[model samples]
Target: MHGPEPGPGEGMGRAVLRGGSVLAAGTLVERLARFARNVVLARIIAPDQFGLMAIVLAAIALFEALTEVGVSQAVIQNRRGHTPEFLNVAWWINVVRGVAIFAIAAPLSPLIADFYGEPALGPVLAVAFSTMVFTGLMSPKVYALQRQFRFGASVAITQGSGLLGTALTLVLGVLWQNVWALVLGTVFEAFVRFVLSFLLCPIRPTFRIDRESWRDLFAFTKGMFGLAFMTFVVAQADVFVLGRLVSAETLGLYAMAVTLAMFPLTLFSKVVQPLVVPILAAFQDTPDALRATYLRLERLIWLFGLPMAATMAVAAAPLLTLVYGPPYAAAAAPFAVIGVYTVVYMASMVSFSVYLAMARPELQRSFTLLRALLLVVSIYPLSLTYGPVGASSAMLGALVLAMVLQVANLRRIIGLRARAYLGTLGGGLVAAALVGALTAALGLLNLPVLTLAGLSVVPLLAVWGLLLFRERHEVRALRRRGGGAAASDR
Candidate 1:
């Protein structure tokens, strides 16, 4: 527990709550748009189309991961004085890396197609390479804004562009009735992000590069670069493995499960991650301060994440039917597995952010590497034995191991009590389980889809409400303390 003392008006707890709310709102909008787009695509194209796209995207992700220079994170964490030269040098390096990735991936597309046994993949992959080039040109000023806690504007530009991209893709998919709509949508999103980043963020870079600036940023960027690469591998390993090992239709079903399981967790992480690093950076020097912030964050994460995971687990069948139709009913089991993992995945992510903020980025990188390794070891054997279902189980195992390691590492670093940590998780799990059981019983009785989905929401919301009610005193205390601090600062 070490970091700077929480200032009167700037407690990390309050900042996280406020920031989470803003981020959550933006994420909700983006997820909704994505959901709409996916619903349309699921209906228009065959499952094989998604599977094909998944395979091509996996290769693109790997190349993007390697070429990631991590200059954005470098900019965020550089508490040392920054200058125009630093931004300029980083920008040019990233531009170069982006170009290199496009060059390699474009030529390698044919090879990837050969490996996947799909000749059509070559053109699709070539088109996908453009996303990296556009994303590379995005201003690091966006990262700077995040550091300054100007999240509203950042959310507007990034999430708004994503919504527009999804809308455009859906429209195109309806018109063309093919995978090109989806591919074009992704490219459009990247382009919009690049344009909006520059428009909203004022830090423009000159073409000049400074040698000293490169050296100064290298230590931070190199470690983060490794972390980013590991992140991409862990995220995409399931898709990569399943696409190669299973049929396209099976891979498509698994992909949908992954999406359903990941969307909520991804949304939660996206909202919190940008805010956590800067808040943590500000208090990095004091272990006690960092410990308090970390505990508060973990609790906040469990509060929301556990409920969402529970709701998804309970409503998986009906929700899947409603959104993806009964043809995708096979995805329900895998969706449940991935939903369980989402809890651990979300918690570990927050812990990783705390570590990064504390300048222990190597630890974050180590954990990511471990997760990726576990994924490699688990996915192949499981896919061979149990096929897509086993692959989903492996993903859950990897996430759980990662979460346990993160919590253990945090405790080692700051001496957190095991009972306190488990209590929150156990309570949420129990509550969610009860709700899930109730929902399952209802499903067993042969209720209508709408009835099942509607009834499921009641118990889920009730469980969440009761949990919050029990914690009302703690929430109130935090608010009172935060309010008093703000008045004193004034």
Candidate 2:
């Protein structure tokens, strides 16, 4: 018999470990600074400023998502990505796209403000849309770094941007005591990120646009845009509904709650998702290998994500009360409900890289569109009775539906059975359930929020340790050999 062949992604685990640590450490520092910034800003600025900022942001994202050309994903997935011609063309297309968004969003700011019934929003959006222009100028080399797992520079740039933005926002918020700090701070972050991307990425892109490259790149973007738009809608549905129906104060409170609750989601976006896509792309041609990779990441991420959700959910009331102080005390109930919602929301994100890896982005598009439309139908009616809490529930329901569809889609794509999926993730489910239960029980003890939350995650850590120990072999394979099959399988 042949000696063990090389495992998929062998020897890449060291890179992943290095990259993950860089991203995680930087992200943790960035997040802590941001939390402090939020604490200071929340006190200085009124809730209306946050509500205004959210709407402006949501609008800008809507336009940007609509115009996305899949330039980044194409670079990551395409073989020609390293060629100067491809990078230049993708860069130009994105630059034009960004400019177009700014042009349209700037003039249309008044209409958006009108739609939201907030006159002050018009000016805030005008400044906020400037970020899109700089955002377009970022080098595609960032994707190259991700594809190769050379995230050190990219992580530094991101952390730097976060720190700069937080500091600027704090200073400006204190001085202006309005939304100018938030809006301009965003633009500052975008400007700094673009500068850093060019410096970090080894690619020296030029002005030339290659015809075939544009066609190939646009082809991918055509498929991706619908999915991006639907995702935007799903993500911003609460803002869309509540911005119209609720008070600014109410929207601000809900924003704080969701921000606190979406910690796992933020971490997934900032670190996990980017790494997974490139790694998954490596295994795409081999179905068995792909399925193995998906299950391992899925199960492991579930174990890690479940506890954060449980802790945040159980501790939302006091977390909000403690973090933002008494002014936001009224936000606790909606915060709790949305906390639970966010944990379940994570289910939708699990298979995203799998779908993209399999070149089935349209599946994500269709399912997300279904979810968004369903939310539109459900949210208005729900908000009529349940208020912002009702809107959160509706959005969560959409997420659940989307997740079920993702599982079915994954089955069709890879022949992985649902029973196998359930079996693999059942431990995570149980751990999360136990954490939630214990948190609720301990919450009755009337401890401080930090103390209560700290206590809540103890069982999570224990369960996680037990799972890690049980799966030490596979875990070791993931850590030592990279994110693929077990060492024995090689």
Candidate 3:
């Protein structure tokens, strides 16, 4: 079953590097396609179209939060995760939750539309939310692929769906020039992923709901649902509060600001996170190895994320002007503020992944609940006073608050000292600060806008590159440790 004993040149290090590379390349292509679609659609459609779609998406998020059973996560965490009976029951539960969410959301669509006072959204929400049905039916066996380190095929299938959805959305946006473009794109994304799961995944989950499966499923779901609820609150609270506080155009601008500000974080979660969870799970029995892996990934994530966040913050005004044009200029301030939030959010997220890897979802629930509570208290007044800027500031506050809690938990759960996290993250902080300071200093001089931007970005990227090169040995050591453990484990 296993390949020949890895030679000196090959081991866990090579395995991880190869898998990580596959994930990175696939994620990059997927993100580029999606980003290009967003850019073109932003240019084609009015800002208000994004605003209306935001409302629909928020409603869908609410239903998902309420119904999340942690089925996918259960599969990832449970020992018998790959068994046919286990997978089949989880698949059925997922399908049921999807149907239940649609059933609950359908009648409430009118209420949500009325809440936003956008009558046109009622029909669109109903139609768009039906995609969850397809999503619910997606094969649970996909998690097994990641678990087995067959990521190349997994990435291909997943990214293929993303590419298809992006192209479909682009076509609709260019032709229809309406909100339906986003609606169609999202629905297509769900549909395509569902179809691909069946084609690509090795296992086929037939209809079943055994008692053993339910027990395993509920054991994970209980805490997961709480985390999902709090996550929904934390994620959507801004839009919910802003929808009431500001005009649709203003809300659209704020949404775009948050999107661009958190671009790197979003991508990390999409690409890098899938790798971290399964890899860390392999090190669950070895404390030193787990910690080493955690620290390495935390640094690796920030190595890339911090500078990107800083660049977004520094070039906010110009980037907005250049990318989405002049109409979005007001978003520049909020973009800068939310950019700071991205740094904190990404850090806390890495720690949270540790909890998930260790099978302690309750810790994650606690962090999410704490952040949600803080956001609930602050988002209203902050949005009232500072508008998008205030909302972004409030988000940063919640991330900081939750990070402190997460650090304390990590200390207790894994016996990791606060100093270790600080030490690991220090390099990224220094590099990002250097990049930010350089960009800020350069901005003081009077020069052509494009030339100034180019001058600021070109050198700092090289600095980031050099830092990454210096860390090469550290990365190799971490991977070797992780790979050795994973190989022995197999």
Candidate 4:
């Protein structure tokens, strides 16, 4: 008799590499779209508008995170057959949650306007809030696509729709000349994603809910809710503190710095995290398999993660001046601090996924809560004193501490040594430091932007190339094993 069919995680190591390739390609295109939009947006909109929107978005993000309920993760991690009744329950629950968010946000818009002294915020937030409903309507079939590693179609639907939406925003922003363009663009993007997800994925929702079906899933969802809530706080705490304590102008500067710092992390993490969860979850029962997978992922993350952070930190001045203009040059300082923090943040993200995959969701929530508390308590006083700079520095300190704690916790749980963890990260730090020092030395001579940009890449590329060469054997071995070769490597 034939055994069970191959599950999503059975060959997840290879599948992750494939998924990462698709994600990377999509990320490159998305990065281009974002770069073009920001270049135009920086010129058209004032920093205050970004700051105002940032505050409103933070609150909205909290709501969205809570609404996740980890249903998708629960479905993915469930090794048993996909039951129609369970999916139906999740669908209805999401719809109800979306409606609740819209209702709450609608009445609360006035409060947000009052807090920010921006009367326009009330309507802007109302329009933006509609996205939650559309996002909720997306079929769980999308996750099925992810589970099967059918990412090419998913990437096209997601990135292509986003590109179109961004293009619309650009045209509208130029015509309308304010935040309405951004609000509309966002709403349009969500609507497009919802429609496309259903169209591209084949699963249909049935209107059947079985209480027995949900019994096995509810605990996982509860754990994820706590994890999501705490993650939201940690992610947005700095922005919230800055908006409340600092001037709008200062908050705007901080917002810009944050956007710059987060772009790389967002791009890379999007590629890694999705793949990590499924891959690690596949090997959950085998400690050796999980540990090996984690190490490989850690190395892969640092290879790109470190250089991106380094390049941003080293080239912050030129990059900001080129993209945003000289008036926003103050963003450079905070960008450097936050860029380094992002490197540590990315590592912590890996640990977070590992814990989730191992079904130790409480550990994930505990770490998130600890990080959030540290971030809030530290940034508040710093924002009060030194303004955005102090707040950025405080956040950097907290991120480093959080990463250390996360690694320590992972070590305790997995019984791994710290030396191996540090080994993965140490080379990247040394390379980044060298590049930064070289960039500083070169800056003393007052080079032109073109010259500076060209010159700056030399040290970075050299360091990066050397590191790749140093790991050449392992890279080859990984490729020989199930992992598909990266485009660049191929």
Best TM-score among the predictions, by candidate number = 3
C-alpha local distance difference test of each model: 0.74, 0.77, 0.79, 0.72
Give the TM-scores of the predictions, in the order they appear: 0.90, 0.92, 0.94, 0.91
Q: Identify the leading candidate in terms of lDDT.
A: 3
Model 4 CA deviation exceeding 4 Å by range = 1-14, 81-83, 469-473, 476-490
lDDT of 1 by residue, 215-261 (tens): 86787676676777888877787888777788888888778767877
Sort by lDDT, best first: what order?
3, 2, 1, 4
Question: Cα RMSD to native, each candidate?
Answer: 3.9, 4.1, 2.4, 4.1
Off by over 4 Å in 1: 1-21, 80-83, 210-212, 468-490
Which ten-residue region of model 2 has the weakest summed lDDT?
A: 1-10
Model 1: what TM-score?
A: 0.90
lDDT score, candidate 4: 0.72
Put down candidate 3 lDDT per residue, 1-490, tens digits, no spaces.
Answer: 1224232324656766776788888988998887778778888888888888887788889888888867877787676777788888888888888998888888788888888888888889999889889889888888755665556766767888889988998999999988898898889988998888888775565655678977988877876766787888988888888888888888887787677777777777766677677767777777777887787777776776677778778877777766676788789988988777777777777787787777778778877888998998999999999988888788888988888888877777777888887877777778788888888887889866656756767646887789778988987787676666765445
- In candidate 4, what are the lDDT values of residues 1-490, reduced to their tens digit? 1122233322434655676789789967976797789778878888777787687678789788866678777765664314566666666777788889998887888888788677878888878899899877876655645644557766877787788889988998888877788778888988988888777764557666677757757877777777787778777877777777766776776787788778867876666666667666655666666676677768666765677677777788787777777767787878878887787787777787787777667777766777778877787888788777777788778767777778787777776668887778766667667877887777777899757766776777788778778887775454333232122111
Which digits, one per residue and each the tens of the lDDT, describe model 2 over residues 1-490?
Answer: 1112234444567667677778888888888898889888888799988988888888988998787757788877775665678888888887888898898889998899999888988888888999999999888777756665667887878889889988998999999988888998989999999888888775566666798888878777777877778778888888888898898888887787678777667876777777777667766777777787778877876776676567766676666766786667677666766766665565556577776665656667878888989898998999878888888888888888878777888888887888877766676677788878877898789887667756766766776778778888876665542445323222
Candidate 4's TM-score: 0.91
- Judge candidate 4 at residue 304 and give its lDDT: 56
Error of 2 at 460 (Å): 4.0
**Candidate 2 ranges with C-alpha deviation above 4 Å:** 1-9, 448-472, 479-490
Clashing pairs in 3: none
In model 2, what are the clashing residue pairs, if there are any?
Answer: none
**lDDT of residue 487 for candidate 2:** 39
